[model samples]
Target: MTGNPAHRRWLMLAIGTGGQTAMTTVLYGLPSLLPAFQREFGLSLAGAGALVSGPILGILLTMVGWGLVADRRGERFALAAGLLPAAAVLSVAAAVRGATALAVLLVLAGACGASVNSASGRLVIGWFPPHRRGIAMGVRQASQPLGVGLAAAVLPPLAEHAGLPAALGCCALLCAAVGGVVLLLAVDPPRPPETGTVRGPGPYRGGRLWRLHGAAALLCVPQFVVAGFALVFLTTARGWPAATAGTVLAVANLAGAGVRLLAGWWSDRVGSRLRPMRLLALATAAAVLLLALGAAAAPPLGTAALLLATALTVSTNGLHNTAVAEHAGPAWAGRALGVHGLGQHAAIVLVPPLTGALVTAHGFAPAYALAAVFPVAAAALLPGEPAAPAGETAAPSLDAASAAPRTPA
Candidate 1:
């Protein structure tokens, strides 16, 4: 370590967050441009949906590959390799006219941008002590909502007034700017000498990591249900105006971001990520069940229950991320985080269609009931402290350097 190591690490976290926010804004936020896409290209609703989904499809294909790169090369290298190319592809997408070409370019951009998801978390694991990792990851995880908010605020107007290319160029510029910053300022965290081989079998030697992955995937069901349909539920089923429903859900989204930070802080205070996560899983189940009951009962109760469900469902994200990285250790952290993300993304990808069908067939009450079941399943799947693997103790040695005293943050 050199002079002002704390400053350097926190600086790295900020850089990572910036990079992540840029990618997320493009990946999830670009959907704000969907109406523009439909108008300009005269595409069907399904076609426009596919265009927006291109990035996620690309993300699924490349997440673990990026993780492998980070593990073998370095976080800085992986991020640069990904972000720079992502920016380039997005710039090309901005210039393209054909819908198919634009969709392909967006997919490629997403593939490149996927690097931050795995590597940024690994960066936090390397630089921060276990005690601080929770809140740090919490702040990192909040990038998703923040990016979405940014996209919602900026993209629609940008597309409407200046046209699609201009809006996409803005997204391209963001990635390019962040890529430049990361290349200049980012540093990989110091690692323990014995932190296993890059291609080592990893923490999966035990069933704990697998259980964690499954539980995380299960938890995603409730999250996506609320995220994808809560507004529609309010507008159609409950007779709330579209603007009012959107406003309430926007507030719920903000609250969801706050809960992620709070969950992380609580995990750090309790000295265990899984415990707080388990509790949140229980809380999410209860909230979703309440939502279902409200769906079957009073409109006011249903809206309140919907807000509770939205906030609680997202609370475990930071905790799960921190726990996975800590469990996997420095050597395998990148790969482990990639797999963890893959599980959640799988659920995210599948949930909307499956749950949409459930809603159509049985209504929102049954859909809410179905969503509640996943969290209950997750709670049952979660490993208690006693079930932690014996090898878990050795992993934190990778961050022993981070145990040094320093800043108040």
Candidate 2:
């Protein structure tokens, strides 16, 4: 590796991002291949949904455990350990004939892949200085949308042209390649030298971290609602063609990725993640309510609002993730992030079924109105400008930090 401190940290960040992108492709992106899954396996819509959801279920169940591993073992080990096994499982999945077996394998892969959620964020927190951490984590957080975009572009067509097995194998190959990179090149971030003094209790002992978790989880409701229903609303309610709805949403998805980076830069500029998160929560509420109004009264207005809401709803994720890690301190960052991941994933999993019922009985406007409440509540729960989190001093100038020698992982 280069001896240059700045280059070294960024290189690690890039590896972490690639690792996460691969995992997200398998965990969340496989849904893009659902039609293929249905055709090949003769699955009903419900069954296909269940199959796709298997990985999420695995993630929820095991994220905390994986986080614990990252905390104790080191980020590089946690990432490679989880990812390589996940890749192996997917490789086996490519050959599996039974739907039940495939579902089981996907769940197992998800369980293993869950390591990236906490480990990558932990890695970011460890490597980057405080001021840059926001953008660093934002870049890390962009992996999800990037992975989904990659899947949308690559997986379905690959499955169509080649076969389902080929698509699964491709996901496996991505995972394995990234895993090998992490194992060979990635280093755990340097920790502060342990003074002989014993550390205090965990961050969760305070109400602040708990409240942050609650707010973030609540925020997830609106995000998933906007994401889950936007295309459906455009196609069914606005009477647009499916392809047109999809194109608009594809653009929105790309924009959403940029929104995360901007939010991170904003937080870095302001020097506080919580303040921006609180404000973004309020912004998201307004956007969602505007969407509700448009959904009820004006087709063109609703369309615009849908796109706005999609971007706004996702704006706070990197902010919250950064806040959680900083506050938790290095000692507990992994587990704290694990808890954070669990809450967000739980919300993501539940939004579809609950909101599907709401849209069914009441229609799009009411459902969006109800969804808007979550971010409003999140805004209420967020902590105002507070003291710096444990393990983080207010950042020195970037030049000063850059001149310091790189710490060994």
Candidate 3:
């Protein structure tokens, strides 16, 4: 629609993907390096795991606030203000002695990280046309694992070669750089959110939205389960060194990032969202079972294949959100995404501790059995491609020349 659209489009994608990586790198980076944290801080395994849990808890509680602020203030200001300061706070935490102080910093990092997501999701939707959004959004979602993967690869040595505090301080600086780039370089979508107070189908008024939310919550179990404990699984169950587990986990994540890009791209081309989700569900289920069987067998190659397969299984990331945005429309997009995210985070918060206990008491098999329940539930909730209210077709549309893109960070 303008001069040199291709170049500008790539620019936007970079900003979208880069911003996501900056925010999520903080999240994924910590888990891979937990062993180092445990040794230095003299933490129990559970205590070290809380380092991962703290930020997630903050994100779970504050997602709505992040979305609302982005909607009101524009993303650039909101993200810049939150992310830059968050980095500073995290750096300060690195220096402090008490566990309480570190936990507070993690929570703050999470809350600030939450602020970045809504804005970024909206940006991707706005930048890429509807048909290709799956791939683009996939890339956007892939940023989480990509950030984690990079951190897994780089952070430990940076810490060991340098120092833990110094390593974390580097992450803080990266966040600052990304924040500044977003504020200075990223372009806002031209339009505001839709005019009506009623977004899509007035979610709370009906059962359908809740059904979708429940499904999303169920689907989130696998993601959180892997994220919280994948490294632990490799280290404890398979007898790999914790460091080796971290490296392999990063490899799996890199594969996952590729999958996300492809999945999102395919969604954009295919009008119907449920088909891919259905396929993903089946594949993901198989991966879970395969991993479980491998663990039961306790073989080396089987475990490796399962880990790699897990990456492949999760490739179709965030397709559910694409379906929602298409069906629900931008009016309700932010809150709707947040509401669904609330369900996902609900799973994130509960699954880890519950499954961790299950692993301790019953074993990984029981924990995975419980984990397998989520994708099945998510698949069941796909809203059967219904007829929209009168003339409504769920594909995203700009209401005006300045119509803004919807985000689900």
TM-scores for candidates 1 onward, in order: 0.85, 0.87, 0.88
Candidate 2 local Cα displacement, residue 378, angstroms: 0.9
lDDT of each: 0.79, 0.82, 0.68
Indicate the worst ten consecutive residues by lDDT in candidate 2. 396-405
Off by over 4 Å in 1: 1-3, 30-50, 97-99, 160-167, 194-201, 230-250, 292-297, 355-365, 386-399, 402-409
lDDT of 1 by residue, 163-273 (tens): 899889988999999999988889888765664656567689768888999999999888767766665587678887544555566677678778889988898787788
Ranking by lDDT: 2, 1, 3
Query: Tens-digit lDDT track for model 3 on 75-105?
Result: 6676687688878877896787777888888
lDDT of candidate 1? 0.79
Q: If both were scored by lDDT, which would come out higher, candidate 1 or candidate 3?
A: 1
lDDT by residue (tens digit), candidate 2, 106-215: 99999999999999888877888776888888898878767765676677667878989998999999999999999889988776567889888777775888888999
Error of 1 at 91 (Å): 2.8
Better of 1 and 2 by lDDT: 2
lDDT of 1 at 44: 53
